[model samples]
Target: MTRPPEPPPKRHGVLRLWHALRYSWDGLRAGWREPALRQELVLGAVLLPAAWWVGRDAVHVALLALSVVAVWVVELLNTAVESVVDRIGPEWHPLAKRAKDMGSAAVLLTLLASGGLWAWSLWAWWRG
Candidate 1:
């Protein structure tokens, strides 16, 4: 006779939260392990507060925070791509280099956007 299928596992609310926290911690640790991430984090910490100080309005503060978050988010994604690419082929393949370059370009775009936002905010604050 064929065995019956097992029931699906049930997750408690606390268990779900714990799992999420665990994953977040893992991601944080991974970021810490990467030199590039550390550099970005340091830069974000410096620029974000400076932006807030220059703007000094609630809306400006929020926008600055969002920009900083965007930079960190992109860097994390780029790191993930680099990690996966390296895992797939540790050798210096042209494709692997291209993948890494694309990730870097994405980060550059984010930085440019952040810079533009800061410039506009500063200009507006000075004018008004």
Candidate 2:
């Protein structure tokens, strides 16, 4: 027998916002629990303040901060992908490997982009 499809859950106004915040907090906690994510969070803690000190102006500071945050965001997403893939099974599979590898690659690209932005900002400041 065919089962009916589930209807979408409804959330309204303030309640929706509250749920969103709660979900975000849960995600952050999960990320913090993950080793790689914990490391990135620590890195952000150090770099965010340094970004403010090293940046030349408000725009530079914001850019630096956003770049650092971007890395954290990407890392969290990568962790999510890995977790989901791992949950699927313990057996070896080409698609699982590809999914995990791609997630890692995404994190690497974000890190590289963030690093390049910071390096450029420093170079510009140095030249001034």
Candidate 3:
């Protein structure tokens, strides 16, 4: 007979939150090893502070900051995808190629949108 399925790890309330935070920190640490992610972080360092200057008000600053955050989110996910794909095998495969391409496409879309928002926000600032 087959054995019973194992239960999920039990983490409750504050413990769960702590684990989540730790995992997020770990992910960031791992992301630092990636060149593209490192560049995005450096870019974030500049954009996050610039948001305060480029935005006209609180909402504008928040939007600008979030837009930069969005790029980080997308890039992190892309890096995750690439890592998984590489882990599967070193040999070339069509499915692996597709997955990596899709991840890159996602990053490209996010970057374009973020750039557009910054451009529009800056133009608005320049007008006055």
Number of clashing residue pairs in every model?
0, 0, 0
Model 1 misplaced regions, further than 4 Å: 1-12, 126-128
- Model 2, position 104: C-alpha lDDT score: 94
| Model 2 superposed RMSD (Cα) | 3.4
Say which candidate scores most in lDDT: 3
Candidate order by TM-score, decreasing, is 3, 2, 1
| Candidate 2 residue pairs that clash | none
Q: Cα miss at 110, model 2 (Å)?
A: 0.9
Candidate 2, position 127, lDDT: 88
Off by over 4 Å in 2: 1-9, 126-128
lDDT of 1 by residue, 77-115 (tens): 999999899899778899999999999999999989988
Better of 2 and 3 by TM-score: 3
Which candidate would rank higher by TM-score, 1 or 2? 2
